[model samples]
Target: MPVQQLRSGDHAFVSYADDDAGREVVTTFTWTGLARHEKVMVFSSPRTDESEVWNSLDAPGPLLGAARERGQLVVSSMRALIHPAPHFTPERQWQRIEEETGRALEEGYRGLRTYIDMHWVADLDADIAVMMHRESHAQHLFTDRPYTEICAYDSRSFAPDVLTAMHRAHPCRLLSRLGELHVEQTPGTVYLAGEADVATREQFLSAVREGLLRTADERRLTLDMSQLIFLSAACAVDLLRLAAASEDHGIRALCHPTGVRILRMAGAENMPNLLLSEVTR
Candidate 1:
């Protein structure tokens, strides 16, 4: 039986002996296991003769209906692994599987499976090491604080391609949580999403500090408060304090639909410097 926890999109390495026992194992797995219900891609050693099983799969059979329901597997050939391999080596194979999966996804294949033939009985250490190295970094976009020149790019003059290149170059990766917080800066405007809680207050304050400290050195700054959710009373006080702290910093805080409502609810709707404007969702 297959591992119940082994999910559909998972990649795996399957190895066996070269004799009849190994062939029978492979045939059984293909016929009754993967080919029946799962989407499985197999990478095998060149020596294995799987043509018979492949041909039989083409004809209508009990497994055919199940196989047709899920995504098809991609079977490839790889070099045989000798026994007693190190742990990290498996990571390379995993990387290959991920790349192939990405390609399949890019080509509009929503589901895929990968199975590699290690051809070795024991390599727990190597496999563990490889698994460790399989960790991946996500792509992210971030604006440079005034203090950091590396992230400083003129968004207005920057061609979309150039901006894309810059984004690609820095790859400012952060947790998905921060992704929702849009901190955009331009010569004449700065759009920032503010949060209401203490944590969000801290983030907004930090952004304000960065802008205030850098505005004279740079130029315009606009703060966009559209989806400004909840904010604590202390947080609102600190936001008011940011207005007091700035001297010559040309930081304009733009309040949109929800932001206007929030400010009105907080009784700060009459603030002179706060700019409430209309913005499309």
Candidate 2:
């Protein structure tokens, strides 16, 4: 699934190695938000020119144009999101964000979604420790709230260590050891793509919750993982937990040959109402 299809309460982190890649990530997310009748906000970095960002989104397309006209799409830059304050306080910045979400709802949008380019963090010589703390705790803002965000970091600019720490802080990741996960719902099945590893533990659990939300207990849910390339021990445990708890919900996880082996070795076979459909090579 595209980043925008993430649950309304999802707080996602996306890392890009290049400018074009970042633009594609933001444009796709903003486009989807508009289609869903949600308000969109974007903060571009100096490397990503504002005009180019707008053009890359297919400037003046009917939907984009209409959204702009309705004031549903708001694009600012790192300079604007962080200026006027002598020092950066994540708390105050976060407050402004919460207020904007409420404003969007009042203006009749379904919800509010924002993407922030974190290149400024490096540019301004900001406090990384404080930023990490803020990112980790931002999860609180999403609980049962119609707010979604993607904090994008430019891999080229951010130190490798910083990137690793950021990944651990965010709940959902656009890319990780698991490639990129797209959890989608069909009539009776929940399909998963990409890799699931320790880095994606929370996202894995969230996917199961999302699947359950869209499903009823009477019918068995078929979780198709044919496209999943890998699964880690930690992620497997979480998957099993959900499957075991889903006894009443009934779940069938279709996995790659290796995934089946992992589950069996992990003792998931003992769980009732959870069937493992192994894919054949």
Candidate 3:
């Protein structure tokens, strides 16, 4: 899912192939939390320098410095966090997180969020079984609580089986980044922006499918494509088929002239439940 779609109580997992790819999502996660008045904590990998994390978050402006000065943003490591404990234990770590969440709430923040690089597992020489157990059983931390977390796994560090297992274990999985296309959503609408061509066709379909499922019982589902720069013919056909399949619900698409033309050519006019509105500036 897009990072923008993540909300409180979402425990998301993301795996990255390199530092650049990893930083892309973490940067957005950190800044978004700060903007939402949520205390943000980043636990750097043992291999990463604290200064590098600080520089990445502060790239656009001095806002990160100000946030740090006020204690809204913290960049630290797992080793330091579990201090006074002789070794890594799930109970000990979870206890500290609960305490931190309470501290954030008491300090006048809306909530607390943490981005933990999974390299800490190796750094602490923790047992793989114990870590996996912790990951699968950590739902208690998020249930009915205002804490959000992202567990990042470095693809190069962990084996394929381990990565796949970890991915399935998490309740939420985050898209690496919103590269060429962006999808945003509300209760009854899914907004598509950027280009939806052959390359991004799958993503477009997935987002639209999710929106349809969410609004299945409602009278209408809106696809706001006012900001979409380009729509391919194949994608238009896919949209038409989806609308045709969901006979009971109406699909309303707000699009520019180009998109309208593509859909019209793809037989949008024949689908009774599909409504297309031309949006003009």
Candidate 4:
């Protein structure tokens, strides 16, 4: 999914292989933030030169440059946000985040959005265990706040374990390749974005099942499918079956009118625990 589609409190983890991709990721995120009247912050990765990031963002238009002048767009080094202190503590860093978020709101921005390069961990030689703990604990900030963040990692530099940990810690990620199936889970909702067809059915099913498994303790399961462009009949039926099988919890699905029509045609009304609603907007 693109950063433009993310909600105010979303936190995402994106892994990029090269500078070009990394620049694009950060540019889109900051641009969206500025457009939405949100304060934008960028903490450049050790692998990506700060000048390159500025060039990509500044090339778009005079808007980004103007925002920077007004202090709405902030570009800082990894050490700047992390150093000047003896130790890196999650509590202290998180407190700073909360304080900044509040300050952004008071400053009249819609929210505070940031892109942090995960390479800082390696650059600082920070302990992996402590950083991972912080990463997981940081999810609390996204649960309910006007904060959005993207932790972009240099795939070439980060260890596989570190990348995996980041994936599990964050609630969202970009679509697997430009326009395939992507699913995200929030406090009480599972969001399905992009298109899913027979070719992507297995992956789509895995995502849905994983979401259900994660939220099994809850009594209600909600899904937002408004961003889904298409769904195959087989997938529609699979959704109904999953809902029916989980009768103990009430299931709600919000999707485009087309999806509602498809579900109805697939006998969705007969499925237990499943309620399909149309998102006309």
Q: Which is the leading candidate under lDDT?
A: 3
Name model 3 segments beyond 4 Å from true. 180-271, 275-281
Error of 2 at 233 (Å): 30
What TM-score would each prediction reach against the true structure? 0.33, 0.64, 0.71, 0.67
lDDT of each: 0.42, 0.78, 0.88, 0.80
Comparing 1 with 3 on TM-score, the higher-scoring candidate is: 3
lDDT of 3 at 126: 95
lDDT (tens digit, per residue) of candidate 1 on 29-99:
44433533334455453444556435444444444444444445444443322223233354444454455
Inter-residue clash pairs, candidate 4: 1-175
Residue range with the least summed lDDT across 10 consecutive positions in model 2: 175-184
Ranking by TM-score: 3, 4, 2, 1
lDDT of 4: 0.80
